[model samples]
Target: MGVICYTSGTTGAKPKGAMGSQKYLVVAGEIWCAVDNWSPEDDYLSYLSPAWATEWVLGLSSGLRSGTTLCFPEKPETVQSDIREIGPKVVFYSARMWESLNSTIHAKIADTLAPFRLMFNSSLKIGYRVIDARFQKKPVPLSWRALYKLADRLVFRYVRDRIGLSNIKWAYTAGASISPDILRFFHAIGVNLKQIYGLTEALMNAVHRDGDIKPESCGVALPGNEFRISENGELLVKPPACFSGYYKDPEATKKQFDKDGWIKTGDAAHITPDNHLVVLGRMKELIDLGDGNKFSPEFIETRLRFSPYIKDVMTFGEAVRPFVCAIVVIDYENVGKWAEDNRLNYTTFADLSQKPEVSKLILKEVERINSVLPDWSKIRRYVLMHKEFDPDEAELTRTRKLRRAFMVKKYKDLIDGIYSDAGEVMVEAAVTYRDGRKGVFKTAIKIRDVGGA
Candidate 1:
């Protein structure tokens, strides 16, 4: 069967479902099982966006080939408790999703359950070490790693027991880059979370392996897949599992493949001396400053997001532009901690974000990161969000990828406010919670002047 299915385009505009052949689907499953080294005893959690191809094959076909029980939670809220209930041998977690999981579990039951053998996440924000640093430290009296395992045994093991993953042997983060904090935390807690590199078009480009986990590298290319770095630092592939062609869309299909059957990926990636792949960002997302300095918006955002106060960001500039600017959302939990510890008084997220003292604090953090970046890559101006983005509202996809077009439209007024001469701008918005409840709220957007990078 051949039918056109849309792609989940995260850049430029809404995704257009492209046509794909059933052979493409069937072959993907065949390639992944062999390359991922799927075993009969392996079990998995299908939590990724199935609308996407690679995840769809891995969740359905590969799971079947591996002869593992596939588990799906009844509801989003049931995910954590269900994982403990099912204890699937492997997992696929997104960076933001895992961060939310880390936030909820840490805020609620971190010390209780923190250990499992074969846990894998698909999206990683930073490394696991970065995650552990976010919380208060507890003194332990065992193998440093074992103690974290015990925390999981105490708290997360019930989750494993409940989910039937009491014996997770390996874990992986696919699709997108995950935060360093989440990666480090899971590994610190006993999940052997590693990075896997590939895209929907080309299924198993590389497996990064169990013992070969690197800090940010996406691992090396798999055996039959051809990989190379272009002069512009882009990644080009010729995988055996690569698609025959985009179904029926010869124009789009021709745009991707080159002579001799090479598929040119639009993503920017580089190889470490060790030959591991370190993904830079989407080819289209690079911010080229007028001064001729180019930087990845994602890289900048990842570093900025590490700050407890900054939650969301959109950095834009062209090579010929004078400066860079962004719209940022505040991270309330860490920011609130800063306020309480310092005895700063604030009644709400809005108040804390707008406070001059808070702005100064964030400014210093921004500057600290900017100092490490090239001059053109620095953030020049920014505005703070009164609240976090909600997924159910469609600002973020089910897997938590920012719908840039959706966000740009939704926050058009606040974004414009960043450029206004007025010292502060107030915006009226419709907000929703995870529970699907909705409400209208008005909040002032605070703009801060950031010195150049």
Candidate 2:
């Protein structure tokens, strides 16, 4: 019998049961063990949901094959503390989890004593300089190397210990595309964070190998896996541990594979000259502008999320539209600290998010991201969402991927206001409380146009 793992349904489509045989699962685990150099000596934290295929292949199956020690937190809320207590050697986190951790670290640093903050910032600057030199294949000066070691001992090590990642040996991030800036930040702090590219149907396909890491790419294909791009730009892969088909959905399963039997990954991707895989976004999720310009919303959104003040972003444009617009969700903790530091008082999330200072803060972040984007893909206008995108609200999937279609329909008024000359729009939103009670509230959300646009 095959094991069934349901898809996360990030596109707001019905979840499909992806079935993989026992042999396939074992082979997948063995492949990961070989690539990751897993051994009985390693300690792993089991935090990812078992319902996800990644957990099955990376945690349970691989742990069984490698005889690695597995640790679990007492509760979801205690994961950070538990990680510190256990000090696992191997760690895997989703993109959102990594981003949140980065935000938390920055917020904590901002609140620290000035002397310590200055030391930390100076240390990070040196680290970034070394990392930049290494990425560019330039030799680092001996003096810089000496300074980096001193900084690591004085600052980076402490930061790592506080975040419960001081002992981490193999840090992997997946589930969604992460900001390259975040990856670079971790590496600057002496963490060997690598990106993985895979899907439920294939278990695991590509992963960064030691010493060949690239923040912008998801590394080369794993051993016994092959990747190719189709005529329409969809990524096609043939992995050794491929799932059989979707359970009880033969028609849908049939569409997943091409006539030649390679699985159609439904993602737009390309291989670099050096064999690095760069996943752009979902094939259907690309935004086409009126002037025939096309860009991936994810491409822009992931970069924008690198800002500590922004939590979530959804970029919108279509063939009928001349320019792009966005809906931004601010990081309440970081932004709140910034507010208090500036002597701005706020009561609720809505009140804080709609503040004039907060709008300007987010606008600056948007412009920073726009600086790197193509002219046609630059965000012309944006609004700070009164509330965060909650998974309970179906704005995001369980894995934290945006449900774009659902969001577009749900926030039609906000999008309309963004496209128009409206200075602000009034929104009445329904929310689900922790006690399972439903409630509604109204707020006036302000929209801002980019200065250069």
Candidate 3:
């Protein structure tokens, strides 16, 4: 075997190492290059961990095969600056990273001078119209097209340059589910961001092609990969170069594939008549409200994350609870900036998170998401978390995918309070500092109801 890449463990289970032969890595790389249209002239940023299967396929194998120049950042903190300096043509980021970039852009615009901000917002409206028309396969109005061109010159161009995306030719986001709205936002701003879907066990399977982009789908299956939706709605794939098996784990390996040798993706999905692949959340992760209502938490969480104020969110609904509730993590930097601008004082993350004003701010965002959801699946109540989900704390994977089951166990009290009649819950959390010192603290976290629910 050429490599043994471990799954990200976002499903709240122990990660298994998927062994890949040299031919497997090579074929995966070749497929990626061909689908993304990589060439010798392209430049790529190498920021993802080497241990990741994606890095092996894109940075190592593909770089060698396509002869693309791979540039490494000086350090993790310097990635943005390095991108600004090097301006690589290709970049790949996880969903969280993409959301962070979107948040940063909006936060900066929020702080801009009133007149410039107004102009930018107006231009963006026109841009959105153009993007919508294009996605619907309708002709864009000439006036709207002209206005979009003007916007690109006056607003979008500057935004792209500031974010070091001016030279980005092919930007891809994966590793977790992302909001289609986020994809539309980027397209509206002239960034060619697309979603690609694959897994460690099954390499590259589907991607958005240049002229055939679908914000709501992961585009079509790659040239050498085939997809089939099983009887129970699980996405099954037969990739050109599937992973050999789980390292030293025969039982797990056997369970990964069906009798026909098709890899069971464990994700619910559908293939559209036009051959596009729309992946739902993990089958096991779907929330069942027991009253014949079921939904994907990721669908709601991704939309809520679009708000600059919300950094991360987890939605919960169970057989015992007919309505959905949520745990939200605020974007500390953005919220802190808002607090300062409004002359609101805060001492710590917990203090800032629990503030009445902050709760109102988050409530607006929650209501925005709830507006688009069904009555049965709407988030009726939510609590702003005291701190961000930490990978070191085992609440999130290194790739920033939530360990849902782990989080449920860890925050059992806070979740119970959301379903209960209580207005607040006392939360005692353990803290681990950078220097390895550990401590514990307690605080009262307020739960707010949405639309009197």
Error of 2 at 13 (Å): 0.5
Candidate that beats the other on TM-score, 1 or 3, i.e. the better one: 3
Clash pairs detected, candidate 2: none
Which stretches of model 3 miss by more than 4 angstroms? 429-440
Could you tell me which 10 consecutive residues in candidate 1 have the lowest summed lDDT?
A: 117-126
Provide the TM-score for each candidate, comma-separated: 0.77, 0.97, 0.96
Q: Which regions in candidate 1 have their CA more than 4 angstroms from the true location?
A: 2-5, 18-23, 105-166, 244-248, 306-310, 319-321, 332-352, 355-368, 390-398, 403-422, 431-442, 450-453
Residue range 1-453, candidate 3, lDDT tens digits: 899999999878899999999998989888877877788999998889977888888788988889999999999798789889988898888889999999999999999999989988998898889998888788988888999999999999899889888888888888988899899998899988888889989887898998788888998998799999999999999999888899999999999999999999999999999999998899998988999989999889988999999999999989998699999999999999999999999877888999999999999999888888888888899999988898999999999988999999988888889999999999886655456777789988998989844
Report the Cα lDDT for residue 383, model 1.
75
Q: Give the winner by TM-score.
A: 2
Error of 3 at 162 (Å): 1.4
Whole-model Cα lDDT of every candidate shown, in order: 0.66, 0.90, 0.90
RMSD to the hidden true structure, all candidates: 6.5, 2.0, 2.1
